[model samples]
Target: MMIANLTGMRSFLILGFPGLSPKHYGPVSALLFFIYLAIAIENIFILTFVIFEKSLQKPTYLVFCHLALNDLTFGTLTLPRIISKYWFGDSIISFYGCFTQMFFVHYLGSVTSFMLLVMTLDRFIAICIPLRYPVLMTNNIISVLCGFAWFIPLPLVVAIVLHALTLPFCKSNIIAQCYCDHISITSQACGENVKIVQVTTLCMAMVCLLLPLAFIVFSYISILVVILKMSNAAGRKRTLSTCTPQIFITCLFYLPRCFVYVSNTVGFSFSLDVRIFLILWYSLLPAAVNPIIYCFKTQAIKEMLKKRLRKTKIGIKIQLSY
Candidate 1:
């Protein structure tokens, strides 16, 4: 937020508000802490609802449960730092601290992206290949795929950690973004021999992000055509609405990623204002938005939450009456 302020309004707008500001960090920290607490409380409610409610037990909702967990992983990674810095203003991070944050951000981010691809593919199979979906997206398949998503990025993060940590930081160690982002580090390291940053960025994008995005696009395009031809507007709306939250999430992530990649590889002197703004929007706001998107966009989940909360309140009242 301070970075956005320093950069100017153009920078702040480009970054999209994560609902924080330079002057507001002290108070803003309290708000974020409450937000994080709410996320935790909401998640606890979700898990409890899923566990006790047999009707809600299914592969699709299970996938959603996993997504909520992933949100926590990504959310906690960035939010605490914001809260701490705002309350304490202790903005300095050690080598391990910054890398730890980056590793989780990248790892969980990749997992979430891949899981979203798996989700659309799951829907495609279920809708397009209905009989097989039950057999195909079985507990074992979900387990294996989710496990694979969890582990696939470990090796990639390990390599990045090594390369990034190995770089000597005789220059200024202060990271410019809200968190320790790769571009910020690379920019500081850049000189005549910026080849390493370019190569690493390319390799990371290709092997980590691009492949999954390609698959997602291909999968969705085919599914959309099939839905469009269904001749039932209601059916088509249902299918698309089911995927709306996921689509919104994907576009938010991929769009800035496109911007970041262009800025990094093309060696464009991307205005510092522009760059910082992009980083915040790309990294922070997504976590805050994910839960709200799910609750609002998906009626089933919304109802589930409401029913559980109502029941819990009644139970408490009953106990108190005793």
Candidate 2:
């Protein structure tokens, strides 16, 4: 029944949107579809690299691994389903299946948001109190942080799923996006999603997003104050150089999130295409962009990638020699 609901709604969009018409946006759509394919591929390599490589076992790399995994899940939550609409044309999904997608969409998002906060805290301890870095971010503590990242969102998702089971089907089931996002469900909402909006916004933006951003702000501020007081000019410069990339990456995540929170609250009544397009821009683009930023922005990740490439070539040569 849930699958039927999801399928019927997706079929409606494929049939109704006339989005494929080759007039204005066709080229743009085609370009985005291809870009998403590359995003999917890059994230796959990143995830695999993080998972199988013992060299990436440091605290910083551990966070990167989790980020890569979240990126894979984040992209999967929407892109595959969207790609299917174009490639397969309106696939069927059970009601429970829709719940599953919705759950993951929330799940990955909640985790990513929390991960950003923890990443900030990790950086905070490392930079501000360098003497205690080892004792501060222990593996046992990180496991607890990881647990909080995931465990916090379950109740909200369970609520959404339970809500889905109760929503009456009239001729009212129209999903405007390529996939079912929470906002789309709210647009078709038959019951209490006002709280969903408030709580989810609070969780996603305030607790997870804004709080970390604030920490990033304060952490960097504190770091700068310390740098100013440092007697060794060379030490201060080195610290700033190392800190610059992390700060830039924080901006990349935070700026867009600010926009998303405002847009979601203000533009709830806009046309379906407009609303969904905005949501997709916020949700999907960040996940794809983060790895690129990490590679380009952070010296450590760049060096790691280069080191891995060298190892790959060495392995290839050995294989050929045998």
Candidate 3:
């Protein structure tokens, strides 16, 4: 078996939206730039609000803070390169760089998946086992769960990334998508071992993506049963309200992924441009809308933003008078 030397540098070109017309580049780049900016600012606001507000430091809010951080990191890792690809025409990345990007892209995704699961558990306890929720989801326990969500995916993703790095990439170095990902990069490797990469990728998807999705579905079903048992209309309404945002976010994250995975597993084909667009849509859309969903749906966050805006207005008035 031939081994690729890790010491030598290899680079890959990220082809963003193949056959994109030069005329549409400016509008597309501008739109993406604003979207990236919105994601950054919105997530930062969520993190800051959760951290500084004493009333918002419950287990639920802590999870939101972690999610905001995850979105910020995911957006930061992905958008800049693609933005530059469209704006400045800089898309080539070094071999190690590609691996690094690929690792975090999947790693953070796995973390987000688990975080959503953790959030589901939080909601389940609060709604289904209200009497025991305080004991079950104590501050210490929530902290531990948060740590697990962030760190548990590390070893699994590391193993996969190392395996991909060792594969000989003697084929075309041009990636069809705007970012480096496990499947896109692995597809370019030249050898029978490529089949191993494909199988492993599929297994990783099942483990990292499907498992969390299953747990989320189960958690929601349990919550629904509990809610239905509640005879008090107000109580039932409150419980459903608390759950709505999470359900929306979870569906946003998982549905597109499920589609992509099933399509690949069944050998369902899509045009290259369509595939790239879907990948970009799922990856970026969730990050962009997550904070917005929370802000609009969660009363606590909405009130906090209202107070902050009022304070800003008062400060502006004082400055104008001066």
Q: Please write out the lDDT profile of model 3 over residues 59-98, one tens digit for every residue.
A: 9888988888999999999888988988988888888898
- The digit string of per-residue lDDT tens for model 2 on 215-273 reads 66787788788888989999988877776656655666667667766767796455656
Model 1 lDDT, residue 148, Cα = 81
List clashing residue pairs in candidate 3.
Answer: none
Better candidate number, 2 or 3, judged by lDDT: 3
Sorted on TM-score, best first, the list reads 3, 1, 2
The candidate, 1 or 3, that scores higher on TM-score is 3
Best by lDDT: 3
Clashes of each: 0, 5, 0
Better candidate by TM-score, 2 or 3: 3
What's the lDDT for residue 177 in model 2?
Answer: 66
After superposing candidate 1, which stretches have Cα over 4 Å from the reference?
Answer: 1-23, 190-194, 259-274, 309-322
Model 2 TM-score on a 0 to 1 scale? 0.78
In candidate 3, position 30 carries an lDDT of 94
lDDT score, candidate 2: 0.65
